[model samples]
Target: MAKGDDLDPKGLIEESYKIEGISTAECRSIFLDWALSYQGVSAVGIAALLARHGLGTDHHPMTITLREGLLAPHAPKRRGGRRGRVVD
Candidate 1:
């Protein structure tokens, strides 16, 4: 895999790949950290990170997490709650 880039400033994604038999949940946590640490837009960062890593159906947890992140919705939907009912 390519060296950690600005998208993964903490090297969380790179280290996640090194972890053998890492669970998807763990990867998700790492991805969250990576996402929070990254300054640029997530889609752009994720795409660049994937390209740098040269991943293709490797079934690696990090790969799965990155792909899932891409597929995930951009806008977070509000679940039914008091906050959801609040209005200006």
Candidate 2:
């Protein structure tokens, strides 16, 4: 096993989300996608996170991650230059 596999799970999950090319929104999205990508969180585990978020099994959906919430309008804006900063 990799050195990190033995780490505390919360720390490992946080570290995995920090790996290069893994953005916060992608991490949030993959929390759902994770169901398919690997052995994945247990059905019980998925149920727990969903319940913690007040998501009903029947209809609630994942909200945008913090970064996505901040950046959505910028999806159409040009990259680079000084306009990047949100003005007061």
Candidate 3:
């Protein structure tokens, strides 16, 4: 994972926000791609990066969706079940 200055040299996040009429779903996809590419960066870090680049998610619906998607808690997996049945 790239750090500090190396985070997004390609400016993908900026481009995503520049697209006219882009939807929240599209932003989510773009955000996912961006996040996945930066292995060491946390979601909060990404948000801060976007903000520093003038694409803050706070006022934008699409960006807000991306932020929420990144920060949303993961669902817990069930430990022993095929539809909750015991394996014995």
Model 1 agreement with the true structure over 1-88: per-residue lDDT tens digits: 4556666888887788778889999989988988888999999998887886645646887887788888967897679988789996
Q: Pick the candidate with the highest lDDT.
A: 1
Task: Go through the candidates in order and give each one's C-alpha lDDT.
Answer: 0.81, 0.41, 0.64
lDDT (Cα, tens digit) per residue for candidate 3, span 5-80:
4565556666766678777777777677766776565666566665665444466645676557566698998777
Best-fitting candidate, measured by TM-score? Answer: 1
* Candidate 3, residue 63: lDDT: 61
Instruction: Flag clash pairs in model 1.
Output: none
Name the lDDT of candidate 1: 0.81
- Stretches > 4 Å off in candidate 2: 1-8, 11-29, 32-41, 55-88
RMSD of each: 3.9, 13.2, 4.7
Candidate ranking (lDDT, best to worst): 1, 3, 2
Candidates 1 and 3 compared by TM-score, better number = 1
Give per-residue lDDT, candidate 1, residue 82: 88
Candidates in descending TM-score order: 1, 3, 2
**For residues 45-66, what per-residue lDDT tens digits would candidate 2 score against the true structure?**
4444444443332222232242
Q: Candidate 3 — what's its lDDT?
A: 0.64
* Model 2 clash number: 0
